[model samples]
Target: MKTTLKIAGALLAGWAGLAGAQPPAGDADIRHGRYLIQTSGCNDCHTAGYMQKNGQVPEAEWLTGDAMGWQGPWGTTYAANLRLLFQQVDEQAWLARARQPMRPPMPSPSLRAMSDADLKAIYRYVRSLGVKGSPAPAYVPPGGKVATPYFDFTPKNLPPMASQR
Candidate 1:
C-alpha cells in the first residue's frame, strides 16, 4: 500500500511539471515569428551568406548558425544555432537566455526589449524549422588563436579621448 502511494505521488508530480510547458503555436504565431525574424535582421549573422546573397538564402537553411566568427576586444563569438538551441531548452529557458547579455556583434539589447509574446513567437518560429547542422565553434578569448575564418572587429586608429587632455 505504501509503495502504491509513492508511485502515485511521483506520477502526479510529473504531470504537474508538464503543465507549464508551452503549447504548440498556432499558424498565426509562426507567421508573426517569421516576420519578426526577418524584420529584426536575425538572418544577417545567424544565417551564413544571408547578407552576401541579399537575403536570398532558402528558408530551410535559415538560423542554422555560422562557422564564421566576429573577433574584437571581448572575444570571438559565433552566432548560435537557434534550432539546436531550442531543441536543447524549453520555452522558459529560452526566455531566460534571451534576457541575458551576449557579446558583440549580437544585439542583446534588442532581444531583452522584446515582449514575451514576441519572444515566444520567435522561439516557436525557430523551433518549427527543426534542428540542422552541428553546434558552432566554441568562443575564443581575445588574442586567442582562431581556426575558422572570422571578421576582424578590432577598432584601429581612434582619436584620443578627452580624458587624455
Candidate 2:
C-alpha cells in the first residue's frame, strides 16, 4: 500500500512539472506571434518608417500600415494595417486569405509556410492590439497611377537588338 502511494505521488509530481513547463495558452500564443512578427521584419513596410527609425516604433504603433507603395511590373501595392485587418475578419477567413496569392513584395509564400498555430497566434496578437488606422490604399494595376508616391518601376535602357532586323 505504501509503495502504491509513493508511485502515485511520483506520477502527480511529474504531471505538475510538465504543466509548469508550458505557458498559458492565450498569453503564450500572442507572445510567440509577436516574436515572429518582430524577427520576420513585418514592420519594415507595415509600419511607416520602421527601417528608417531602426524599429524604434512602440508596440502600439506597430503594424498600423504605411502609404509607401511598391511599384513593379505587376502593380503598386500597399502594406496593410494588421490591426484593422484582424478586426474585419475571423481567424478562418484570415487563414484562407493568407493561403492565397498576394501582390508583389508582400511575401505570400512565406506566409503560406507558417503553421496553422503560428497563424492563429498572429491573429490573436493583432487582435489584441485593437483596431486602429484606415485601410491601405487600393492596388493600382500595371500602367495605372496611384495617388501616393510609389517606388518607381523603370526598365533598364538597352541597345537595339539584331534579332529585330
Top lDDT prediction, candidate number: 1
Question: Tens-digit lDDT track for model 2 on 78-134?
Answer: 999988988989888998998999987888899999999988888888888888888
Tens digit of per-residue lDDT, candidate 1, span 88-122:
99888999999998999999999999999999999
Candidate 1 local Cα displacement, residue 39, angstroms: 0.7
Q: What is the lDDT of residue 164 in candidate 1?
A: 100
Overall local distance difference test of candidate 2:
0.87
TM-scores of all predicted structures = 0.86, 0.78
- Scanning candidate 1 in windows of ten residues, the lowest lDDT window is 15-24
The C-alpha local distance difference test score for the whole of candidate 1 amounts to 0.93
Which candidate achieves the best TM-score against the true structure? 1
